[model samples]
Target: MIHQPPVHFLGKTLTGQPVQKQVRKLKDLDNIFLDQAAFSAADMNRVVYEVFSYLPVDEGTEGGLFFGMTHLYPGTVGQEFYMTKGHFHTIENRAEYYWCVEGEGMLLMMDKHRNTWAEQMQPGSLHYIDGYTAHRVANTGGGILSFGACWPSDAGHDYATIVKNGFSRRLLSVEGKPALV
Candidate 1:
């Protein structure tokens, strides 16, 4: 249950992460690529994305809240847009909330049956991803597409499924705008 905190705490900027700073490269997105050849040919040394995770301070509880920010660099491979290596949760029933803080992007989601959904996101936009769906966010606009997300600490990422079977729809840049192809 949600309860009020007993003591005061200091707040910090989202970029201030004392826990983890993860960098994702083109090679890291191997399984989620629509154009495998393009991905393989793209510079493996290039840093494609970044993630900053902030864990709860001394949360001695199961399924506690965890927050993080993902930064997808703006670019493309062939026609497919640059996207995060999306994933489903190990605990399939767990959900997450994402709030866009910078740039523009799209949250692409799919279910086990290949049904797809896409949401246009800009600064201040908020979205929820159901635990039953596999989701990926792409940088469809210029600059860094950054978003903050919170989920259950126990809701581990299951990227294997997404890597094995990519999303049914692809977000492409059509006429300088995002188009689901």
Candidate 2:
């Protein structure tokens, strides 16, 4: 797949016309809280950002290649960076790949056993999230943090696990920079 920009931001390209797409809003993330003091259940209805998935060739297919973009707005809850609700693939054996197309952030990954890894992300940085690993993205930049990702269509997100237990570690904003907390 090519660049998956927001539908409203697209125009006709020389290759082909941009397909109309749906926007997935992820505003309710109180369940996946690491810093309880920072996240408030009353603010769960607040909109954080949105995701736009593009699968131009997948008419009715599953377990095939699908790519999309995640635009994370800049903000913070206390010292914690704004982040995505991390999850594992429900299919258990389907890996996913993420590439930072714009802005700067950090990818936090962990396994069922709590083995953790943190990677800094910026324009052109790439990361491979192995199967069974729960992953989340944190925006550390001053503006929007945009990243593109691809994975098998059948690798559904299992967010309940992460919501229930949370990640082994958390990403915090330390002096306006990302730090492991």
Candidate 3:
């Protein structure tokens, strides 16, 4: 089922698309799911993919490609739940942010200088960080930590995915034939 402009988050609806009404979903997974039908292409090449999961971007090599996302989940009644493991980023032009729709937690942040900071994140709370800032989300409640994340490809480069993964890297720029810091 098609909808108007600015459809819901993650570009889809939980109800699934009308074209595949016959599909059946197993209810016990309590996993990350994306209602793909709620979103549409802005142009010929653009596309949207929505899903529910415990991980973000999981494991991949699309680190250099620009992509955006939004997440919505209901908080549970536990203290050990979180959207993802603590992580760090390596990109240089990412603009990332998160809006906590439910539950409470701490916004973990670390910078290139190896400094750290933590801020409380509750429902209706929002945080936006620069691309160079490394950070992650830490849930500390007996409820589901629900939030929405939306950012350009630049956002990924500015996140804490790298540190969370115990990684090291070196990139060379052909323009000046030199390595970047």
Candidate 4:
């Protein structure tokens, strides 16, 4: 098989070529937020976040790597902070890495046993997500929260599991500060 040519990127700014973009709108996360009323009353067309990925090889290709950037806008659905739709990898043994590149946030993680925890994310912070963990990112700051991620190309997302069970904890803004509830 022919291999992809070398690619370059601006690490700090997350700018690169041959990237695929996907935008996630408020309506796309129907049951993600804690406040149903707030979500219902909010603008469904509002963009919550966007993902830019540099997939050198087709997704789900074994032995290949996937790189991407997640840009979560600053906002809230009621008291809850804006967050990604958390997910587990279809290939449960697949691990991933996340690096905070442009903003402040929280890397929330939950294990298969439902135990949950979080790590503060800031520019230059790096995190390792274990294979058995399901993870989500929450923008807890006053500005857009952007981060870079790397994972095995074969580690397909298992969003259905998260949508079905949901995370054990929720990150909310209390008195203008981020709190895990």
Candidate 5:
């Protein structure tokens, strides 16, 4: 995938197309067995950043691949250290789903209006975010918030950067999401 910024701010590619980039070797992800995933607050931030490089969605994320999601390495995220800040993903349109593959955490659901609700999650847990729903992934335990996301479309391409910071996210539409109801 190429990120050709508009000629004005991104500078001129003369051809208007971004420089050509190719996919070479795929990065090898860390080998973590379930027994190793015991999240502690001190390691939360670093692990999240490190695992981002290996997310299934690590395309342009690593090399510009789009339409991807990460099966969070257990213990890579989720710390009771602080609250899971909020964020949103807007594509041409938006629809999102989170499937818990491993570990557990708390999901804090906040609407555009900022009303909130919280739910505990675990492996096999299916958390669906049908757009319009403002949400946060909180680490309510000593484990990582390892999970997977299913976008109805390629909306997550934009979300890759945003979710990592764990803050500075916007809930584009508040209309459909039930306000933590």
Candidate 6:
């Protein structure tokens, strides 16, 4: 098979070619957020985040890498910050890397045993996520929180598992600062 060409990206934007974009609105995370009352009263149509992916090879291709950027808008539901729907890799052993390009946030991770941890994400912060862990990002800043991610093309996402079993810990705003609870 022929080799796929390199993909280029600038800051939080993908360049040189068109990418597949997925926008997640507040309504898309009906049961993901912790506060039911805040979720119900908020504007469901408001955009929460967007993912831009540049896939050079077909998904699930071993040895191939997929690159993407997640742009999480600043907002809150009750005291909880805006976040992505966390997921584990379908392969279970596929690790991934995330780099904070801009904004401040938290990288929340939970292992298979339900143990949870979080890392502060700032500009230039890099995080290594191990396999078998469910991971999610929360935007705690007042501006857009953007980050880049790289993982094996074969590392399929398992969102359903997280939907059924939510994260053990949550990142919430406390007196204008982020706190893990």
| Highest lDDT scorer | 6
Model 4 global lDDT (CA atoms, 0 to 1): 0.91
Scored by TM-score, the top model is 6
The lDDT, on a scale of 0 to 1, for candidate 3 is 0.41
Tens digits of per-residue lDDT, candidate 4, 3-28, equal 64555566644454678889999999
Model 6, 19-107: lDDT tens digits are 89999999999889888999999999999999999988899999999999999999999999999998999999999999999999999
Instruction: Please report, in order, the local distance difference test score of every candidate based on alpha carbons.
Output: 0.81, 0.76, 0.41, 0.91, 0.39, 0.93
List runs of model 5 lying over 4 Å from the truth.
Answer: 1-45, 49-85, 91-93, 154-181
Ranking by lDDT: 6, 4, 1, 2, 3, 5
> How well is each residue in 75-171 modelled by candidate 1, as lDDT tens digits?
9987788999888988888899998888889999898788998998998899999878888999988798988888888888888888777788888
Candidate 4 accuracy as TM-score: 0.94
Backbone clash pairs for candidate 4 read none
lDDT per residue as tens, model 5, 24-138: 1112111111112443223433433111221234322423332222322223212122233345655423556665555556566555454556666677788777565655564
Off by over 4 Å in 4: 1-6, 11-17
Over 18-97, each residue of candidate 3 has an lDDT whose tens digit, in order, gives: 11111112231122112212212112122111233222233333553322322323221121222333344444556566
lDDT of 6: 0.93
- What ranges in model 6 sit over 4 Å off? 1-6
User: What TM-score does candidate 5 reach?
Assistant: 0.45
Q: After superposing candidate 2, which stretches have Cα over 4 Å from the reference?
A: 1-27, 35-37, 41-46, 56-62
Backbone clashes in model 6:
0
> Which residue pairs come into collision in candidate 1?
none
